[model samples]
Target chain A: MTASPDQIVVRDALKTYGTGAAEVTALAHVDLTVDRGQFVSIIGPSGCGKSTLLRLVAGLETADSGDVTVFGADPDQACAAKMIGFVPQVPALLPWLSVEGNVTLPSKVNRRADALRRTLPGHVHREPADPRALLTKIGLGDSLARLPHQLSGGMQQRVAIARAFAIQADVLLMDEPFSALDEFTREAIQVQLLELWEQMRTTVVFVTHSVSEAVVLSDKVVVMSARPGRIDAVIDIDLPRPRRQGLLESAAVHDYEDLIRGRLQTAWAAGPATR
Target chain B: MTDTTDTDQTGAAPTGATPTGAAVADTALATAATAAAASVRRRQPSRSLLRPTIWLPAVGALIVAGVLWEIVAINNTYLLPRLGMIGQAIVTQPSFYLENAGVTLSEALVGLVIGFVAAVLVAVLVTESGILRRAIMPLAVVLNVTPVVAIAPALVVAFGFGPAPKLIVTALITFFPILMNVITGLNSVSPPILQVFATLRASRFEVLTRLRLPSSLTFVFAALKVVFPLSIVGAVVAEFSAPGAAKGLGTVISVASSNSRLAVVYAAILCLAIMGSVLLFLVTLLEKRVLRWHESQRLLRG
Candidate 1:
């Protein structure tokens, strides 16, 4: 019953915004752990602290009371080691930098992390992906010299994806990365994301509001409830490998969707009635 | 619904089309127009200077203003010198005008460079330290509000009637705007992008170089546009306060007007105007090169 060496463990983490009178709890007594290389999605209503959870894991926010650890180290330590790559909901590319420049930014800034990675034991030896090649693979080769403002929302998001992948991080924290796209574009990107994830086997903690999206991509769907946010349920998705659009139309997929949807409804009802 | 579809198919491309069909057609039309416009834009080889809307109106306006000035001068020679008279004055002793203009331009250029570097350094410091920003910004505002004219005489007395006082004046006039604009531009990076940098464990220096400094170029250039003219004005004012034989354009104008050499004064003023325009044009050219990817630049192209 030994814990996995590469696991992320969050134990009774609590976060609140503002001083006493204006205080609003973001995450209350939230406890979760994600195994290495697993794709996990957290789905809930708007105030359910999914994003807060992700941020805490990324070391962007600290818990008020509890401990959050990544690979036996604190979140900040893990972040400093370049073990965490965060993709926010927005594309967040530097507007002044060309697409290629933005994608290579992490590699340029993370020299210390590279040295640490080289010394770490049991880490696989791999050459970092070329920024231009990655962009071309994601259909942005021609746009290498273009700035972020010159790109569409979808293309900008793709650049963000390329940037995250280029960081060569162990765990990628994505907070609703596909939420801004149209449905068709979102589906296309989800597939592309899946393919990318499958190729790299990077652990992912994705936050989203879509039930179908959660069921489609995650190895486990973690449902949360609002009003001092906490996890309500964790549903395991036992679908086959290399999941595709065709699998989305199958009855088995519908059953998983129904199960998650039913759990989500209860989680939603359990929250404060006002919301 | 079936009958409507049949009628829609059989009839002349229906005038009042179905929503879906109309939307599809609209999308196609918009895409085609965008592609055509893009192609047309690509075919042109940096023709922004040749565009009628850009330079034509400016040249035409200048000609019209000159003609009106000449007509007004013909009636009132005591106050306004005729264009011909100014031209004659400029032609008679070109060396005097050239030497004076050269002195002013050199002062402005040197002061501008010093002010620009100092402002950028101070902006970086202020942006890095909240305490310093709070402490310095209020004092900057106070200095900014003090009239340059009021300070020119004090500067002249302190630094004497040489180019030193004029250089100080020009630097002082240009520094504030650059500082303000640089701070604003550095702070304007999206929070999400900052988070991205943070997640990568980027050092403060790395963030400044890779993100903030590059992003601030447009704002710095925008500030330069204001500083360019003010630099000239500050240099001129400082020149006006100069004692003997300083020989800047401002000195030329002052001497000419006092001696009732109206045409010489007009000639100096014309030189000043041309210098300001040339400096502005050069700054604009630099801005276009640096901020080629900026949205404002793209909008200008269109």
Candidate 2:
């Protein structure tokens, strides 16, 4: 059994889109490592390839060069093992499926993943959480039978969150999941997500543009610069565990947010000169 | 049902029913009354259907059209048959028209079923591979552009003077719309949802059955709406162009018109029109029931 503490490793990963003059580099020699059970958030400007980085880790795309590994295996293998869970910006729930059916969807289709996971030495397999109980925990108990369209935007996002959590995946990748929601709904769901994360302690790599969100949820916040995306800084948030919305008022949290913002400004300034 | 509506009217009275002395009792009573009224309203399915306001214009127009038709027939009996004479012809030998109507209806239905199943299966296969799609789609388009009426006589020559030519011609006419619509539907799954399925390692069958098929339903229903009425047209056209031993409304209309039996011709045409309308209504009803979860369906309900 391999005993690496790091659950995810991205080394010198480079990805580009298009070709010829129109070709643009999405990620340029980006490197990141996420420790087991760590909550890491990747935050940057719109074109910083934060989503590209998340997609790489989700095995949804291949890097032009370098490597991405989860649980000592390649991203595709880990994904095949049902070890990667994704929550996209949109809820992306099946329109015909009820909230319960949407939550239970991963479990139903993961037969191939299950068999792959069994072959890995020292891989601990827990029975997936009951989708109903997870839905209730996420405050969707009453909407169990409702289709995705029937739920409000926030409620639909919560169901999406519940679905990702239900698989008990070793790695959860979220791409700006709360960006579409209103301010109040976003904050409420952020707290709910933290609570869920505390229980699971699965390695998470969340991509977002919100600085406060990154500071609140992540153990390590990865700030990337745009124009050929590269990691500009990695800031460790020393906030106490069981983080709540109440902590947003504290000075320490504000300091971390400011520090990240300052670093981001520097990264942004560092770009145009090269262009 | 009467008692419920009665209670609803009384319960919805403008605040005067509340007792002055007991405010708490008044609140509770008001709440119960509102709940009862709401439930009663829900139990009465589509009150708009029964409303005179909704039906008055439609009924009035039909009545006016009927009177105008009768007046026209009185002036020109050869060209425009009186409504009574057409009705009399149908009443005198109802079984003859009924039998022919049944044949046309059955042919349309059987052809529609065959067309629908074949289109769906082929669409599913086509969606699976670009190679098959490229190879087959042009052929389908070519077939669609060729008038099935023109092909009906050749079909009769090829398949003999039986029901086969009529069924084939009908199936050919209805196939393209459904195939095109279902193909579009199957490919319409959102990228994020497709990625979710990919991450789950969902098999091709799973993706097709659970995601693609359900996603395709709204499109399928849209196509069926057009195709249902068209299926009847296809059968009639086939019957007209390729008449053999079979007796359909198309054949009846043609035979009556040649003999200048304008009443029987119009009567046969009336049967065809009614059959088309009833088929279209059934498709709409099925769509409403099946696509209840769809956004278009929900908006329609409102």
Candidate 3:
């Protein structure tokens, strides 16, 4: 209840779909708190409500019960204040727009939202980053005028990452953003993403099913179980900073990855029958 | 390595003037070659236009069809005129066909403009409101299923004679395709993109204008390909129903056939075909320009 202006707090948030005989619970009693500028990952088996948690925090879906707050305000208010940026699993660049156009769209739209927010008393507004410079930093300078279909899968995902960074949001929620890329491209983008995050210092809540991915990018990984989805455990990643491809071969990184994998296996085994 | 050493020894021999002069000659030759290649590249597209494979088959087919038509007309003169006679009629009364064809083209174009705007407006409304979509979609389906030819007479009665009925008929024929296409395009946005817009806190109007509208352009153009021909057919049908004092291509066809001027009738039919082709070509050009960034257009260029 004492969540600060820079933190995201979720208190026993629940979400359900359908009704009566067909009713299904997606999330149950999910309580999590992501502090300011912390990179958190949610990892679980399929249909374990990992993405549902991100959606709740994004204000895209309302929790059936309990509360979710961002920066001491409702998720809706936080979203309206242009503090949340989301990247879906698919690289959802507009097909009609060039790479630069897609990257700049959020910034342009946020300007209008910012203007509306300023009409209200005591609203703080932050200027978004330059999209061209951001795209160049993300290594997409050569593809500014290329359409979405012209780019490879990995390139498109990088564009999506650059787009999320371009918005200059206080918090970013990504849903398995690199899931579609090959292993090599995924690692490259991970490094690029880490560099961007390090520079911006924005809070991130990334949802993924890959243990190595969660371990590599997140400060803490929240593991959840399905069949009435709920969080089972939280694992803190103690690996050193500036995590790079070299760290992937390190014994310490392997140990952390193995620990999370073991917990995920246990969580998967502890199903509805055990509950 | 050996080549560099050889060049170095040669330069060290105090005959640098000879090597330097040779290098200058080589640079000039390279520039001349590059310019020649550039000119060839510049001429490539126009050369492709004149290639035998591109135009020969089409021209051959047209000649064969013309010969067949002439032969058939010699045996059945009353039913089908000779190709030469139709050409003579077109050459003799060019102004008559031109004026009537212009009237039909104008009607179709006006109706298309009105129907396109109305379809876009209705599509926007349906996309924004679930209630309107539910109520209006079924009615649109019913209208689409009803034949325009069957409605032409009723339209003539409702709007009376003159161009009003023709315009309505053309609008009616075109409205449904545009509506269906616009709705499909507006709704075809990927859910992930919608989620991105939602996260950005884009206003409903912004979502419609920025995302939905641009996404719908390809579909709109696709629908236009069908609408172009359909609009002309509608105008001709409407003219048939009510061809007052204002003569259109449909009136020309009816009048010529009644007077047994089969050549003039064929000439009018040719004019209609040409009009349809021209409109389709214009729509395609517009589509290429507007959808240059789309994958379909990109694939087409390749």
For every model in order, the fraction of real contacts preserved is 0.50, 0.46, 0.50
Interface RMSD of each: 7.3, 12.1, 15.4
CA shift of A225, model 1, Å: 1.3
Give each model's whole-structure lDDT: 0.82, 0.84, 0.82
* Clashing pairs for predicted structure model 1, backbone only: none
For B121-200, candidate 3 gives per-residue lDDT tens digits of 99999989999999988998999899999999898888887888888889989999999999999998999999988988
Clashes of each: 0, 0, 0
lDDT for each residue of candidate 1 in B1-302, tens digit (9 for 90 to 100): 34333332333122112111222213344234334434544444355447675577889998999999999999998989998999999999999999989999998988998889989998999999999989988988899899988998898888887788999989999999999999999998889999988988999999999889988988999999999998999899888887564579999988888999999998999999999999999999999888877868754443
> B70-138 in candidate 2: lDDT tens per residue?
999999989999999999999999999999999999999899999999999989989999999999989
- Selected candidate, larger DockQ, 1 vs 3: 1
Report the CAPRI category for model 2.
acceptable
TM-score of 2: 0.91
| Model 1 regions more than 4 Å off | A1-4, A118-126, B1-39, B42-60
TM-scores for all candidates? 0.90, 0.91, 0.89
| CA lDDT, candidate 2, residue B281 | 90
Tens digits of per-residue lDDT for model 2 on A230-266? 9999999988999876778899988999999999999
Least lDDT summed over 10 consecutive residues: which range in candidate 3 chain A? Answer: A116-125
Q: Sort by TM-score, best first: what order?
A: 2, 1, 3
Q: Name the candidate that leads on DockQ.
A: 1
**Cα lDDT for residue A127, candidate 1:** 77
